[model samples]
Target: MSASASEGPVECGGDEFKTDKNLRTSLSGLPSKIVAGSGFHGFKLNVKNTGDRAYQRVDFGVFAAQVDEEDYFIDTSHLTLQYKDPASGTWKAISLDETDEGAGYLGYTDVKAHESFSIDLRLAVDKSAPAGLGYAISIGMYADDEGNCVFSGDGSYYEFDILKAGTAPGDPGNAKPQGGKKPLPQHQPAGNTKIEPQGHLAQTGSSSALPAIALAGGAAVALGAGAVFVVRRRRNADSGTAA
Candidate 1:
């Protein structure tokens, strides 16, 4: 999947792409080629407080959206978080379950007035994942002071593709196969008619088979008649020879 293909539709009108004044955040450096066995710590989420009010307990979240069904190959399992130690001031890997707010988010990253908070982010794609698939990544931020940060303040959506392993970028994407083809019109029984699996055409009604069986029986009767006539001819020939 190409990066453009993974990026969903963008609406041009009416605050569709505007950022919220109070909380503005962006996720950057997502890999175009995601590999399952590798860890990427270079990706980052930066949340900045743009509003005048300084809020406490300000929390930020990294939420993922799998836009297409193919997203099953990649998930939050491929993402991890790290925090800078307040004492050592060194980034240390942390468990999402330890930091998650129980509302399905990554961390409770806090930001202060006119300041920004950034975290070390990582992503890994499963080695077994198919050649093409992706997930739409977004940063979800909320705080005690406001609902969300966007003027539209919804979510910032970004795209990443699990490019086909052997193919270069811009290659034609393999189409996702469509499903739910109406099962071959099952043989429906009307009244007492029964459908039997006599052979490959079992689903077809049995009436059509009757003519073939009748013709076979007629051939058997004709063969018997021929045998009887041949016996009488042999008996006459033997009598003529004896005379």
Candidate 2:
């Protein structure tokens, strides 16, 4: 059932459905590096339902942290998430609902079996976001009211660096996939929107302390549930962000 305009979409993290094995997701288009205070940056999220069961609703959430340091959460207040409306072909800001653990979530409905849909997403970094490396942005897709998640394998999260304004990013030709995972194909931006070149910046100082729980792997802490599955990596305990 499609959610009414007034009712909005269903909130994720409920016990409504079971996890589906055929669902898969991938992200592309975002640069490996961005400048602090950069305006809306674009990316594409593709969701594929490879099985035979059509889903009534699907929910997703995103959270970020400074992975180079333990428990150093980024200030998400300066961040904004937006999606391109398929019907209107216009960009709309998603009204984010926070989880008890502080992740942000929203939902979409009516995904038929064996079908695929793509969402054009934009992430706006406000001027106040601290600049540094080891920043990881993670996403989780849930069905069954947040009970079942799409497989938390490759492509669920992306790691990058945020350079201070006026700094050059690393050469794109020299860029390599982090954690030995292959890079997903980049999505082309629509209109005149400019995407920064993909690359990493040299690490600087320490990151400011913010409230966040550390998940064992880079997976997002599901709202009202245990940690969502994602790729695991050994943390570089010696590396820390600038305060």
- C-alpha lDDT score of every prediction, in listed order: 0.35, 0.41
Separate clash counts for every candidate: 7, 10
lDDT (Cα, tens digit) per residue for candidate 1, span 171-233: 433222111111111111111112111111222231332111001111121222223333444
Off by over 4 Å in 1: 1-20, 65-104, 140-154, 164-243
User: Best candidate per lDDT, number?
Assistant: 2
TM-score of each: 0.45, 0.56
| lDDT tens per residue, model 2, 130-216 | 675433333333323322233224333455666676667665221123332222111111111111111212122211121111111
Candidate 1: worst 10 consecutive residues by lDDT?
Answer: 181-190
Model 2 misplaced regions, further than 4 Å = 1-18, 64-71, 95-103, 133-155, 170-234, 237-243
